[model samples]
Target: MNVHIEVRRVNEAGEERTRTASIRDVARAADVSYQTVSRVLNDHPSIRPATKQRVLDAMEELRYRPNQAARALVTSRSSTLGVILGSRGEYGPTSSLAAFEDSAREHGYWVNSAYLRDTQPETIRAAVEHLRRQSVEGIVVHAPQVRVFDILAELDVDIPYLGLNTAERGIVELAEDQMRGGKMATEHLIELGHVEIVHVAGPQDWIEAESRMRGYLHALSDADLPTRAPILGDWTADFGYRAALELSHRLDFTAVFAANDAMAVGLMHGFRDVGIDVPRRVSIVGFDDIPLAAHSWPPLTTVHQQFAGLGRRAVTELLRLINADDAPPLLASVEPSLVVRASTARAFGHQ
Candidate 1:
């Protein structure tokens, strides 16, 4: 059947008007039926290459764009992936998202993303529902909050879903070892002859924050070092600066380990403002080795997570779930590395 479509165009006067360029119009232009055009769009195996070329050429000539919804209805495949994020411009989540999109595109899939405005169950449900309506083949969740998963578990999510920062038993979680990274950061300071180490942590509810804090505590306990209370931060450089101002008045700790590079860099600024030299007075270390970590003043000693690798891995695993492939054993966690730099040094007396 020939289906006619009216496509709009503009004249030299820029007045609104109507133009028609239907599948039938494409068929006439290419000397084929509208059915052939539909088949071409769906990549039906039966269409000859030469005939497919004519339809494609006709589409190009007529500037006809196929409706994705219509195509999905015919093929029962949307070739789309959904990503749900619960970050406010944090480097790790943001970096991972970019890599995931690139990898999805490489696999000939389109990506749709939704950011959580809040962690309320209703918000998470809406985000999932919005993506599901698009007929996404799978969903990759990067929301790091503990409650996000709790809420997700409650939702009747029928599609294949993968989590990037969870270790829940039922959820397919893929993540770098945040605890190890935190331990690595703290241990580096301990190895530098620093005993009075303080932790600058992210929000209390975040999974990454909790994991890294555990690592810090574990390192301290292993060395039999006295533990002071960790200062909770909001994963912002500004918060680090403020925390620095508060800590500068004290003479207890000689080193600080931050949950993220942004806070680490801010801590450096705050210390500088208070006439405290980084590493020389208070050694600092951070996580996520963002691009600016090495470029920060005195350079930051931090943990390097393979965020991009994790993102690519997530896409691959999600696809496997979507395809119902014979799944292989999953990696326990992605390992993180420590990057030693000028920001950390031997504790005051040792130096």
Candidate 2:
């Protein structure tokens, strides 16, 4: 199926001929039809793995490069996706975003991102409009703040959209089960026989923070344990350290569950400075299981979220919506697991 065309050039009374590789050349190399090559380029899910690999190998052998402009004109598809971010610097969101981009590229798509400076309705609408202007086929919203969803609901977004961190059920969204993670962390502490456990939670407005706090309370309530009001934090080590100082004077709680690893590590440092040995006099658990968690002084006992899995699933679902293909089953809410480490132990004196 390879198409051959000759180009003639003359230099110093000498004639030369050459040819450039085309999609048909790739098809010939793979022993596939040109239409099969087109399907491979579009990452059609119906294509078998062996066929896809063969196409990819053929494209590489032929040095075939897809001309995005030409493909867009022929198919009327932009082959691009849009992502809107309300929280940019956090560990969990950033980790998920990296995985999402990697999955998109593997599926033969490019990503365009817009970072939100504020959660204002107008700002959210403007970001969506900007992405639409570039003809993105789908959009992924990574803003976990509660108000951001409210603002998004007010906008007249026409394209397919997926939410990475929203709590709304029955929506086209993929997210780690934050509430389950929180419950797992708290239940770990409870299993260690720590009844008076304090929770240092993230900002009140963040959907993740609220969901986690709800989990913590749910665990304590289910166990018939008295629940103390949670300490709201700004999801920072500095805030965790400050909270530790304030909690040090209150001898009421023997354990603390932090919303994320950064705060947990900082809280550990603060407790050490105050002479409260973790797992000895006080136990600590955190969420997200950031890379540093396992190396902290006592090694943090935390909940591990499937950030990468959720990211990949988000792309698959969004693409399904874009293609209007509902034949494939979608993954459910990602589950979280508890990683027990040195930071937690049986109740004091029971050890």
Candidate 3:
């Protein structure tokens, strides 16, 4: 017996239309049992190569797509992951989220994010519960605040979660080596004969800020240089501008290490306004070699963080945990490199 059915449905225009191809249609077109089609869809090993090829050809001809949601329902795998994201508008987090979703989709999974408007304990709990109810297999925590980590640790949520750009204490974390970047930035200035270096640091509570400040201090300690009070900032260009104004009154330093590029550029602008000639009077270096860093009035010297690579690895690690697979051999962390530019120069009056 031979039977091939063309599925038909009525459209909003009151006209008959051919619906999208389904697995049953593939089975009918391939002249195979529906169960055989299911086996092919799941890559069952028992299916002969000839039969597999035939099924595949039929599927390609019919433009058939298996319903991921339906497959998920049957296999108890939602094929979806969740992310708890903070600092959504920042360059690094924004770039990382896009790259993370791209990598997840390439692996046949979907990503959902719950942006934290407030990092309060109760608010964090509610966000966690919302994602939990969505049946996401795993979660990536992109909240960079130390307090957020404490909040997440207190929650009893059972889902496997990975923290991005976080510390390595009792948590699986992925990030470019920020301390290395910080040290590299400071060392660049030190090598240029700038002994009196100041650091424009981010908020103390941020993991990156803490690590960068530590690295800056370490570099000074190794050089037998005394540490000065760091100008704490909010990671904003405006803050950098203000810090530069403050530093103008105390011309004790020959160089400034701004924690990130945004602040560094603002510091340059602020110094110009205050008649402090950069490089000649004060050399500047920054972390996170953002795109605009290269195009600034004087191209910036900074450390480049691999934001995309970190995001990709975060998804990979989270998936392994979700699948209950043994952890892969630890790979080398992504190393940031120093990018020298006109923003840095040899110390003024140095030969």
Candidate 4:
């Protein structure tokens, strides 16, 4: 049923006209039953694809848009997914969010994201409670901190949830092969003949950081190179700068591999300030080739993680569990690429 309002006015000088496009109007234009139009709008799986396409084409020709409140009342599902993320400002999370939203819309669902202002247990609990109130059908947890898992375990909510990057054995989780990525970064430096390569790695709690560190160690072990313990960092440029200055005192390694591009950029800045030219004196490499990495002062040589593909994969896996579909075949690990740039060069005496 559609509502119509009559607007009466004088003729000629001031006249009123009726204007509306309703579901019934769309059905009449499409020459289909009103129930068929409703089925198309609701994305009923039973409808034949040809019929659905025809209904969609007709709706477009008639300019049909459904009323949200009315539709939700009929469907009994929110058509919304909750996204719980650590931060919205970071390059990785934001990139993942874009892919997640795009994929959700393609599947006829909307997103409700919560960028945690605080990561405390109480704060995280509150955020989940908030999403529950919104009646979100599922959740996509983009929160990468180790503490996040702990909190979620405590809540143990029954709603379907997905993680962007974490090792949760049976659940849906997606992570760029951080270990392989780490090894690639380290191996690239070794190929450049940097014998003494130190690493400025992200904090120990992060799953990626730990995997990357393991890779670094594995590569060094394979090459019979010295295993110099990495200096832990906070995944920030400021920390990178400070770590570089601290390195000036020890100054044993001819190369450095920071865990992320931002830190690598900061390390370059720090090296420049102290007159230690990159590649000439100290070669450097980083990970997660952020948008600005290619344009950095020395053009950071880093590992490129396919975040867009990862996001899409996460959605696929999550939706599989959400819809109770058969599990997908085992897929190969996401390969991270080593992007060589001007930041690394052959060892001083290797020429």
> Model 3 clash pairs?
none
lDDT of 3 by residue, 39-157 (tens): 99888999999999888888887778888768767777888999998777889999889988999999988888898897899989988898877778899998878888788888867
Q: Per-residue lDDT tens digits of candidate 4, residues 55-129?
A: 787766656678765776788677778888886677877887888789889987888877788779888888899
Model 3 local distance difference test score: 0.85
- Model 2 lDDT tens row, 1-351: 243333345666576645456788778778889999999998788899999898888777666788876787778798899999988888788888898899999998899999999988888988998998778999988887878877776675788887877745213333337887898899989888999999999998888898899999999999999999899998899998888888899877889999999899989999999999888999999999889999999999999988888888778878988999969665755688899999998877667
Model 3 alpha-carbon miss at residue 280, Å: 0.8
TM-score of 1: 0.87
Estimate, for each residue in 1-351, the C-alpha lDDT of model 1 and write its tens digit.
Answer: 243345678899998787757777888878898998888987889999999987888888788877778778878889999998888577788888898899999999999988999999889999999999989999988887888988888885889897877776223333338887899999999999999999999998888899899999999999999998888999999999999999999968899999999999999999999899988999999999999999999999999998888888888888888898886846435578899999999999896
**TM-score rank, highest first?**
1, 3, 4, 2
Q: How accurate is candidate 4 locally (lDDT)?
A: 0.80
Best by lDDT: 1
The 10-residue segment with the lowest total lDDT in model 3: 167-176
TM-score: which candidate is best? 1
Candidate models: Cα lDDT each: 0.87, 0.85, 0.85, 0.80
lDDT-superior candidate, 1 or 4: 1
Candidate 2 RMSD to the real structure:
5.7
Candidates in descending lDDT order:
1, 3, 2, 4
Model 1 residue 37 CA deviation in Å: 3.0
